[model samples]
Target chain A: MSVTLDQARKIIRQTMAKGEDMKLKPLSVVVLDAGGHVVAFERSDDASPGRFGIAHGKAYGAVMLGMAGTAQMKRAEDQAYFMAAVNGVFGGHVVPVPGGVLLRNAAGKVVGAVGVTGDSSDNDATAAMAGIEAAALVGEI
Target chain B: MSVTLDQARKIIRQTMAKGEDMKLKPLSVVVLDAGGHVVAFERSDDASPGRFGIAHGKAYGAVMLGMAGTAQMKRAEDQAYFMAAVNGVFGGHVVPVPGGVLLRNAAGKVVGAVGVTGDSSDNDATAAMAGIEAAALVGEI
Candidate 1:
């Protein structure tokens, strides 16, 4: 389904709830539509002030590459210059981290993505996955 | 209320819906928190790709100056050097135009700002006002 505001809010809610249930730190979450545009975002009360930017960067990176954040990170692993160039061109909107997960529709079409931050990379990924599942979408991260 | 993700999304939705209803050109919109950081943003399907940066710049300018984009433009009038200084210091993240509006909370505190770009500056300002109203926030523009 096309990413709607309701869907975006649902994903954010689910992700933050998962963080709470797992006793993870307060998190920042962001949802982006297929066009690499933000649909929704939230930085929890206890989340670091900088979490919002990092969350958006990760989600934007995932959407731009059409892959998981980790995959992008791996691709940029040996190319520091490439990563730097991306950041320079995009105004620091690329964060190749495990917190970003691509979302797919039932037909396996990439619909959008979710990005989470404020915890360990693995925990952020797990929170994002929980959000994708809660929205009844496939998580590819 | 604080500018939550839901509020930001609502503002964007209302702004774009107004654009559609008015038969205006596609627009790019951005929302920034009180600290002058992006909270959410969108580029309409038909919007020019470059509009994203411009929209963000306008919003950032409004938030940083605690005034409307037009006001900022007026303040910089006849002072090209000042405008250049601002651009240099902020890395060109300021667009003093009519599209940006400062959002205020119930207590009259600046909460965030919204920026729209696509049509004429006046039309952009109208769209931003629509969004702020829809979000139940004060609009200073």
Candidate 2:
């Protein structure tokens, strides 16, 4: 599956707008290709500078690991050893947070991921999900 | 400027070893290329899974923007608009945290970056610097 630049841009715009409507503070959003390379990113003016990195990592981790950072975090609680081994193997690029939403095609194959930061983790996840749905895509596991 | 997979792996190994000697909890480390692409990553067995993404984003943002995410956070205090514009433009992958260390050559050209998480930002930065220096590379601004 492929994610177009246009689609990524649209996701950013729509997500930002949703953030505005929610009266959330500044935000950072990122979209990644299936290969986990960045396709696009945006940071709101009021967002903390660190928000961008956090958001990007969340998104990239989702794409690379095929799960949300939140979910990964939960699993880490029980499988600390495995998580540590994977982290060492991957060099710490995979995060399991809710803020990351996987993009899936109609056939349900993972295509890409969207990640957001700069608000509560829940809000960030919500915004990313909004963007993915806005792009006419589904957010899967 | 480039950070090869071998150098990145070495950095992670050295950093982890140091962490172990110090009896520090598990850590997550990431190396990024000049283009902010992941070259290598690792998560210590005891580290949180989320640290992986956080570390990767921090490192990528440092390399992409030529500064630490913590410094970027400081800049955001005064330049909210500029920061926001950047967030919008980059789609949220830029972080200005202290854990990010830019890799440079003697010629002072940025080659890549290293980011560490699962510890204080300051400790993460320190470990990253040690790794860079161990690789016989320069880390700066």
Report the number of the highest-DockQ candidate.
Answer: 1
Q: lDDT (0-100) at residue A87 of candidate 1?
A: 81
TM-score of the A-chain for all models: 0.93, 0.90
lDDT of 2 by residue, B1-141 (tens): 588888898888887777777666678888888777889998988787688778877787776556666767776675443344344335555566677788887887777888887777777777777788788888763
lDDT for model 2: 0.73
Give candidate 1 regions above 4 Å deviation. Answer: A1-10, A20-24, A32-40, A63-67, A72-93, A104-112, A134-137, B1-10, B42-51
- What lDDT would candidate 1 get against the real structure? 0.83
Fnat across every predicted model, in order: 0.20, 0.00
- Please tell me which predicted candidate would have the highest TM-score against the true structure: 1
Minimum summed lDDT over a 10-residue window in model 2 chain A is located at A45-54
Q: Candidate 2 — which residues are off by over 4 angstroms?
A: B1-141
Candidate 2, chain B, TM-score (2 decimals)? 0.88
Residue-wise C-alpha lDDT for candidate 2, range A1-141, written one tens digit per residue? 678898898888888888888877677888899998899998875453446566766777677778866776676566756655565565555555567788887888888888887766678777777777788888753
lDDT of 1 by residue, A2-62 (tens): 5665677778889999999999998988888888776667777656668867887888888
